[model samples]
Target: MTQQGVSWIDKLIWSWAPESFKEAGESIVKNFWLHWFPAKVSRRSLAFNYSFWLGTISAVLFAILGVTGVLLMFLYVPSVERAYPTMKDLDYVVAYGWLLRGVHRMAAHLMVAFVFFHMVRVFYTAAYKKSPTGGSRPLNWIVGVLLLVVTLALSYSGYLLPWDQLAYWAMVIGSNVAKSVPILGKKIQFLLIGGTEIGQATLIRFYVLHCVFLPLIALTLIVYHMWRIRKDGGLACMDQMVLKSEKERVESVGSKTYSLLGITRGMEVNVLTSARAEEENLIPSAPNLAKRILWVTLFTMFVTMVLAILVRMPLEAPANSAVAPNPAKAPWYFLWLQELIADTTIRLGRFTINGGFVGGVLIPGVLALWLALWPFLDKSSPQAAGVWFPRERLRQNVVFTLIVLGILVLLFIGGICRGPNWDFYWPWQPWPELPMHF
Candidate 1:
């Protein structure tokens, strides 16, 4: 009954459970949760703060998505003919199916949101910088960036699985954008959709991608990211560690004696031990990480469930290749690119550029490359590490803030302000009547 409080099933599974099984369970928890945690962390590193808990919340959201997604797989049929009806059945027929569907949908959304915020938090605190006072590494920054990409890819791939009119056109616009790339555009689009156009093959491809490949990559990267966080001194304590190092260095020398090397004639050699001091600025990982994971998991799941109840998962008309919605749009996350296309065009001499390539491939590609190289590119002092929006880092922060604001502005325009034919219109305006695709 301890395994399942509902009773009969629990009794069947656990009442006759061996004592050895119980001992093994307890031992596993002790080894993995208790022993592993304390070995990785120190007392001072566990600060009770919002920023410190973003990663945990993101991880919890991922776990929720994984569980709900697996449950959904049991009910969903990926073929175009059955997909929409199956989705409807999930909502109308299956018991608590809507709850599972809603949770999975909302969890993916929240996970992406949290992961973006997590990156913002890391950037502001300069956590990607290596410590000059010693205990830091920047390699995880690249891992974090790759994880962000995988998270977004997972969302985008999953978006197509519903195979509604909305999902179909969104993928069409997205795939068209992929076709805008220079020489490899069509090849990439074909690879993605499994054909030149979206069809049955595309549906299965997306299902496999969303269900398998992207999740596996994301999980692997996330595990490495967490391990690196611990290896790099357990979350941005560089500020305090730097000060401690200075204090210890001063104490080791006894007094501020002038170096004889500077005076010239002869140099005084002070013998110091070769062993390095093991400084403990970390909080106990067992309590800190475990408690954080527990609370954040509960809170995130609760909010997601509430959202699932209040807002029904959107299901539009069944996909018809003969019809296209007025002003077909990409998913919200990629709406900024759509807006960019609406606003800009590139020209070099007599040749004009594909707006899709410009906005979707070129701009995003440049941004991604810059981000991947930022830790190596940044020339900021190590003292700037672990400091959020410090005066010394004002320039860097302002640049990043402007970039974020620009993307948000574009998202707003594409998502809320575009009308039929992509004309400018206010969000409050009633949507124009749907027109049949020619």
Candidate 2:
């Protein structure tokens, strides 16, 4: 292209783009979506290693799930008789339906995983601590915990939509776990399945929870979670920057300070005295933060699409309430809990203690409560807020890491080591085949 043409193109682009930082800031203020983010962010907040961008990936996955889920809703019927057939139609008859379901399913699983990893990132970095200049971030941490629970609920609810033997048996196991609650167990299970059995009511209940109630709750929590991040002064790393700036200001009290009249010397001045150091590390969120988010979003979507095409979602035989699988298992995420229940069950000759109540209800409840309350319990120095595995927090970090590893070990055992009849077996061992049911 000629220089004249290039100049014309640049002019056209600049016409829409902000010509100055002031204009860019004003534009962001005026735009609804852009307004969610702060006008400027610290450079540290945008680095890939700082956050691994897991939170951004999670939001992208949620968006993908929303779009694909809405599309699937049009073709799916909540009725038990039609649910299985409709899934088969999605696989074979509908154009690109298989791809749609694959992407949705994969995104759902990935969202759960990424949300979890994001929480772990926050915990390890002590991001949930209060900022020196901002309000308590532990409140926002609680909101994040709620978001994780809702995410899990959304995934579990959707697991039954296929109405396959796998889905049916898994749900049966899940509802029974709910039934292990002390006094309200039966009531909760009834509310969940809508009756004494897993029939049409059960399907519709899960359908509604998965499609409507849970998604709306998740969306609300997500909005509050992001807004809280901004309200708490960007990311927790910004706290470290602010504290560093304060320390530097104290140390440099002896440095020369220029008066307003001395500006004529063409010397640079820190006019915004209090925020001078913070400003030095800040960059406009408009192009800098926006571009990084765009990159992460695109990368996540592309990978999800590739996986959707390569991996096939399973569709087992239609649900059979009568003939249960030899080892009926819950969803993979719940496998750890299942294993815990099995291990915790105690039988003393005549009396028995329900393992479901102990393992599924008590243990997880205590863990979740502890997780949500830990920020308040934490006694580390403020300097440790944004640093990963700081020496000051070594003991807590070790304990937390051990807990996470224990859950992973249980998950591996339940998913891989448990065979038919829920018997223990090595991964490489061959299992004796059972007679065909049909």
Candidate 3:
């Protein structure tokens, strides 16, 4: 009776003795040893793979953005009438407002960066070239490209909250450039302008788009994107997977001769096997997973905290529908393009050229085509599995590197050349320089 009572007491103590705390403490101890101990090493497992790792990072970033963005909206009022004023208040009136604004801005930038990096990672591995995600590449790439655009859109829309002369004319010139689109150009201009100029209507339109529509779509696509990652078998190479499936499907080649003849347990296997090799290069889960994820989360949170505290969000002056500000700068991100257009001068008699065609249209078209052609050109079948480097992979790698470098150069040239009013004018005018006190 005494021994049974002791055992029951032991069980009760184990069960109720702060399980969460115990688990957390265990994790901390294990991580510390794994992280810093000289004898530490990684233990590999297949719980989650590279695709999950990437999808997890993206999902985390999105979650941070969604939460932070919503909090920001509480302090933000999207109207020409109140937008600038609200920004000023967010800067000074609210507690930790600057921190939040900073968090919001920086988080936005990082999220965009991560999403792009994720796509590039997916491309290089040929994960998107095979079944599942491969079969769904068209839709996947569409989502990726649109995410990039939406990220830019959010950044641009936020630029106006500063309410400065710079913000006003930047929007004006930006809207003007959009109006340069072929065919539906005027229609877009009208839709944007509401009555043909940047005003109350424009502010409200941008506000809604930035705060609501883009975010909603981004969230939806993000979910679909993660699901695709799981469907694709955790970044296993397309060729590798295909090869494995085929070998399994036709393991014997219908050779009943071996069985019927009973030729001394004939077993000269024909199917290829890279299972051992594929399992070798994988990132381990137990320690590496916990460690990488912890760092990523910590880094992201630290960034948010720092931004929310140090920087102040700017709000621009009132919008003047009638007057145009001078020297309008493109959004810092797009200035590279505007600067390019500014230098597109000096014509050869009759034939003139514009840099916008090269910077805006041609470069983007070339990049889009290059990305689309990647699966076809990267002929190293993932189905081949664990064939890390084929005979002449050097040529393919070089081609890809050059293509990337070419795009970077074009964007760099474009960024350096672009500005307001075709790079000639300023966003701020002399009247503003004269200093009218409110």
**Best candidate, lDDT:** 2
lDDT of each: 0.77, 0.88, 0.57
- Give the per-residue lDDT digits (tens) of candidate 2, residues 1-438: 444443433432322356788966754665544666688888999988889999899999999999999999999999999999999999999999999999999999899999999999999999999999877699999999999999999999999999999999999998998899989999999998999999999999999999999999999998888888888888898899888767665644446465446653422243345466677789877767877887998999999999988989889999998788878888888899999999988999998889899999999999999999999999998999977888989999999999999999999999999988789999999878996454
Please provide TM-scores, in order, for all candidate models, with all chains considered together.
0.84, 0.91, 0.68
Model 1 CA lDDT for position 405: 94
Clashing pairs in 1: 42-282, 42-283, 43-282, 43-283, 45-282, 45-283
Give the candidate order by descending lDDT.
2, 1, 3
**lDDT (10s digit) by residue, model 1, range 192-281:** 899977999999999999999899999999888877776776666545565555655666467535444556332222212111332334
- The segments of candidate 1 whose C-alpha lies over 4 angstroms from its true place after superposition are 1-30, 40-44, 48-52, 132-136, 251-283, 346-351, 431-434
lDDT, model 2, position 424: 97
What's the best-to-worst order under TM-score? Answer: 2, 1, 3
Error of 3 at 17 (Å): 16
Q: Per-residue CA lDDT of candidate 3, range 239-278, in tens?
A: 4544554565366545433532344453323322333334
Model 2: pairs clashing at backbone N, Cα or C within 3 Å:
none
Candidate 3 Cα lDDT to native: 0.57
Better of 1 and 2 by lDDT: 2
Give candidate 3's root-mean-square deviation (CA, Å).
Answer: 9.0
